[model samples]
Target: MCLNKITLYLLLFCSCINESYSANISEDGSFQLNGYGMVAGDFQSEYNRPKNMTLHADPTGPNQDPRGKMGDLGNSFWHDYYTSLAVTKKWTGIGAPEQWADYTYQVVGYGDKALETAQNYGRFGGLNFLPDESNIWAGRRYLDERINVFAYNTKEVHIDSGIGYSSKNFDFAVGTAQIDWSSSGAPMAAEGSRRIFDLTYRLGLTEWGITYVKELDNPLGTGVQQATSFSAKYTMPNYLGLIKGQSSLQIQYGKGVIAQYLNTSRISVLSEKGDSSVRFTVDGSISQFEDFTVNPAFIYEYTKRDKSADRTTVIPDLAYSGGDMIYGYENETGIFGGVTVKQNLHHQNISMLYEFIVNNTRNKNGVAGANGNAYKISVGPALQLDVLPYIAPLASLTLTYAGGDREVTLLPKASEWRVGYRMEVWF
Candidate 1:
């Protein structure tokens, strides 16, 4: 809610500029048009071994390869298209004209998808009742408070067709969405909808928020499904020539219907019950460590389930490669530590990350077994370049490698390597 002196100056300077593009103007010439379009795509390759499967007789099932059927395979170019339009006007009674009221509409598409596809359309709109003090809007959008500035926010909660209100010190939203066990595959209508709520406040140097999700009729009959997040962030000014620093702590707890997904193709068809999970994460960033920007993060997670809970429920987001491994839905706990560093080289940015993960499966009595203890290391490197100044021509490449020791009936030991490249042009 606070703007530094330089930002204030920039705002003041921009107010004096006149728009060169205007269409469908109102009688008072207050209406204007603006929009941007972008096309992007990426290609990737992965190599790994098949797990718990034999070319001869397979007990786990058919077509089950622990290392992957294609030990090495190339992914096709996945595409994305995005565009947005906005209209704004000044309300004399509401103070500043530019901040008075505005509306926005956006649409995005995937590879080979039709433009009119309802599933591809993303829309939002808002009416400012009191300039920046209060507003209301609805649509599918990300509305979570992101505390980590240096990394992609994997923790931001997403919602659909949600209404929200923002004031000087507080922000909140509520919405409903279909319950899906994973982000992939077609969702089933057999289950009831889930309701989402989020509220946050800013006070002095820290911001805090709580997010809750509830299931109306959880298929698992595990009572009302609930996941709650309590989080806080503290920001400090820069010192010793480094940019300002930020630290964040977040805790998440979930009970009842818990769904777990791994990779993109497979779905653990077994519906799990008596699922409960807890997770704590600490993330911090130092904008500059000498010539490199360093961001460090740590996570501790634990999940407990009934004897019948599938082992997959205990797995965390393991795409990063080096973090601890949680193989299945047993009672397990995991700890992860990682650091990401970015440095500017010539006109490009080079970034690298390294992570260490350790996890163990424990019984109801909290006794760990060697059969379940696992460890892993993950590494990733990436580079981005702006080859052309016009239309924001850009290209990037990333590589990730992960390997570790895991005790599983299937593929007790497995590793993965992936390389990907992306290209984009915008206007």
Candidate 2:
């Protein structure tokens, strides 16, 4: 029960359940309610190896797991919780519109195990004729918007019930999805249904988008699976001199099926190539100092898959799968950079943040020094209070440090250090 008294009794039981659910919301007519909730606690430390340090060449293969190394060390603890709720209604009888109409209903629930596997229902309910140009109804939502940090970003779609169309620049949506590969142990695949489409275009600070997916009936017999994604973004405000720029680009193409784990015979192979990636990023921001603010960014990525002479097989060592070396089926190219700084004290309700990142990987079938690099840093301080008047409370604490090598751990080294805490309350 120690661990700082279980993190101070889970932060006083999540601030007494957000002050008893903040008096069950609902105020001022025309039906409207709001919500937000968050809680986080984390601790991490890494590096731990010994026990024959092996990737098994049959030194008892069945017991091998632990070679995603990169500065290895270990220790961990976690806690997470999320909540959201929204309800809105505005309209007076017949013909609805005359001025601002509304329709909304939302719900969300989350957990990190413990609330007995907590899981809540409905999230994203809709209906609006001129609700910002157009609207429809849906259940889950966050329809595609490509952004990546570590692969898997073909415009992350998530829409259960869908329909959309917007104006004042353009936006569109169409959906259907329910794909679960059972935690992706991927014995081929299971749990299926997919169909989604997205499109976007915005002028003025520039924007562009596209998304498509169709993966019907995939019990992993293959059969059907197609993906496409493209994205673009641009911004420039007071360019150069006062700095304020932004850039983004993304691309993806696919034909799915990936699951490589032949760790010297723990076996699990299912390759059916055709995967691609190209990512780009550029960032900027500078606020002529005063209360401080500076942001910077850079990123580049290139991923690939679709190489095989029957996907090789002939092992007894020389292992390293998925990022390959399994007889040669590799891919990876990255270049990352980051910087973030924010400062605002007192008058701004306290705030401070710092971040840094650096990564350089290369292993497209390696051989020239096989490149590798990694770096990360974080710092934090935050406090926003407004105790009552619909309550508002927030807290933060962060510290992080990361490590690298073997192009970020293809085993042979690793590192980690993390400390986190977060609390929030809102109405």
Candidate 3:
């Protein structure tokens, strides 16, 4: 049979199996199944483009220019679909025996045009050792978070075994996972393996609470990676004479080794092999204002590689939301700042955003700084419909204007304009 016929048959078989199994659960045990499916389509347009900017243009370019006509629009389109199903069963033992399990499956399809576009299919399952205790014992979990077909990739799975305890004041969990990383993304050595250990702790205080998580990853063929993150918050009590509301301050820091097995030519190297980086973040918010609120955050990151290079970044953001209007702006290191404002109406919601970035560097080998300086501005509006309580449709129309100056001999300046729309539904 044809490929399309095979896909149709497989979908039908899955639906029938779900229906048959859902009806077979014992009445004494509670069973529930839930699922959702979504489809999305997108289109883009641009202008004043350089030859190198075209998707299908020749790779060799010293003076490539953008195609600028109706047929030369150089636009490509694709659609995607995603679906997830979850099942849970709970049972109470009359005497002393008890057990429970939860299972979920997710599937993603990238394009309606080609089979090679199929992205991923995932399955997860969790089992509990005891089902009838105030602090029940939970044990086993298996997850396949990343899966890809059309390649030699098999399947990436993680098996986790852990213990968890919960209390009114605090909760804690410790788990160890074995990861089969070979089949994770674009395919690598089949013997690749990773071992992970994680711990989470929570403490409650009179005025606030604190939470922390520490995780470690050791790969059999690679290096060891570690990450630690924490957050704390404080709230004001009404009993205090002048303090009436709540305010929170949170901070987090993390540093670790980054790993990748993909070919460098085919991947964007965010960090070099055996590289280490430190990240610091701070966030604060206050609810003292009656109808309006303000939030501000800052982040700093520094990275160093064993042999290649090093870099640093800083970002700051501020926002205010209340009434019918919401506004925010963000400034990123070496990049542009962005500002946005939104207005809400009884029947519709509208918003606009603008961004401007400048890139300048003395280094001649760097990818971004190779260009003298680049700036871009984008503005758009969005609409949301609340026709039903559980169902709402969203649509966004955006206009993007971008330009940059390259010191290269061929193409010195480039610019473009693009438009796009999107819609979504949820329950």
Candidate 4:
């Protein structure tokens, strides 16, 4: 709201009209206020039936196959509460520590209300000062704010804030911004704005970047109103030399209003006249390993729309009653791959988890759910407090596989199981 009233009148004129510039701010120069929260609950059963499901999952099962993920596509299941908040400032020795400032806020909701879903780093925050080795942030900054949508910020559109800069005289450069909205208070023009140009370099284990996203203003009869995107992120680290972690690759391409949120573009124009999308991802990690640690991920996505986009039966003198279920999708494709293993079990707090997944989906027009191939198997045990596992309480046992898709029909096509307990944490 007007940038929170101009940051509360510049913090009330810098603590009441600056008291000698407040000792140039430094008391060992470090401050942080961080937060993350999780509270989840779910119970379901259908196999020898009796558990009387509640709060979700296993409707026709395979976790209802792809509903734009968050445990769904992977079938891990979470029921509610995911949040993050942050506050920070830096300046040490009363001099330069690459001055910094931070403010971040996030919202997530599911059952029983936690702000009823106003997802992701909304009203994000930032402030940086360092005219040397990089740091000059002014408004809108994004790089997957407040994380978690199963990571990789679900691949781009930057998010949105506005007015930004990076390359405090270059150090390989880094500048970001994000804003996306369709609802959840003020922000119009269909609510999406992206303007970015990137340059990053680091080689020793590989690190590369190429980014360009330009989306802004749109909404007059829709046929297109600014849209373009390009992305490339590459990283490689120790794997074979000893497997100390890190592996990455991401590729993206979009057009016309960033092509339908790619999943949640949040809107701001372009629904037809050539919509498009392309995506690819590869995840990483393999941390040392003695007790165990390994991670892997892969994703691929493709989307296309413009087969005369937008429809609700296109009003034929209007007079329908569920008559047109909107069977239109133009095209969509997906593939997922996964592997996760962790085992420390003790002194490090506790952990024992294993997972395996495989997925495939396709649609050219399917009534809002299910397509094909799905398999996920998770085994779990976790207990860690505060630092690392964040909170605690977690139990897992999931097995899913429903490869029967004649356009989905009660996929009791075999394997399905879930042993649950919620309460996730990450800090």
Ranking by lDDT: 2, 4, 1, 3
Q: In candidate 2, where is summed lDDT lowest over 10 consecutive residues?
A: 1-10
Judge candidate 4 against the unseen true structure and give its global Cα lDDT, from 0 to 1: 0.40
Best TM-score among the predictions, by candidate number = 1
Error of 3 at 148 (Å): 26
Residue-level lDDT tens digits of model 1 in 300-403: 65656566643332222232121222233456555545555555454455444343333333431122452444333334444444443223434445453434
Q: Model 4: clashing residue pairs?
A: 140-162, 142-176, 142-177, 159-178, 159-179, 160-178, 160-179, 161-178, 261-265
Stretches > 4 Å off in candidate 3: 1-42, 45-85, 89-191, 204-252, 258-274, 282-298, 308-342, 348-381, 387-391, 402-414
lDDT of 3 by residue, 1-427 (tens): 0111001101211222344334334575456443333443225311222322211111111111111101111112223233334344444442333433333232323233323211112211222442223242345432111110110001111224555443344434444443322212212211222333322234553212222212243333334333332333332343122444333333322223211111000011122234443333323333454533323233333333444333221111111010111111111122112222233334445433232223332211223333344444444555665453123444556555545554321123376565544444432
Task: For residues 1-427, write the lDDT of model 2, one tens digit per residue.
Answer: 0000011111112112343443333454556555666666555321222211111111112112222111111111233355655555554444443334445555554443322111112322134434554544444444322122221122444555576665668877776655443222222323356677777788887777766666666554546555555667766674344444434333333333221111011112223336555566665566767777766656565556566524433222212122212323456566666666768774556687676666676752222345677675667786786343225777767776766674444434576566766676666
Tell me model 1's lDDT, rounded to 2 decimals. 0.39
Superposition TM-score, candidate 4 onto the true structure: 0.29
Q: Over 4 Å off in model 1, which ranges?
A: 1-99, 110-132, 145-155, 179-191, 218-224, 238-244, 254-275, 306-329, 347-394, 398-400, 406-413, 416-418, 424-427
- The prediction achieving the highest lDDT against the true structure is 2
**Every candidate's lDDT:** 0.39, 0.45, 0.29, 0.40
- Candidate 1: worst 10 consecutive residues by lDDT? 1-10
Question: What does candidate 2 score on TM?
Answer: 0.27
* TM-score, structure 1 vs. true: 0.56
Writing each residue's lDDT as its tens digit, candidate 4 over 317-347 gives 1111111112344466667676777787655
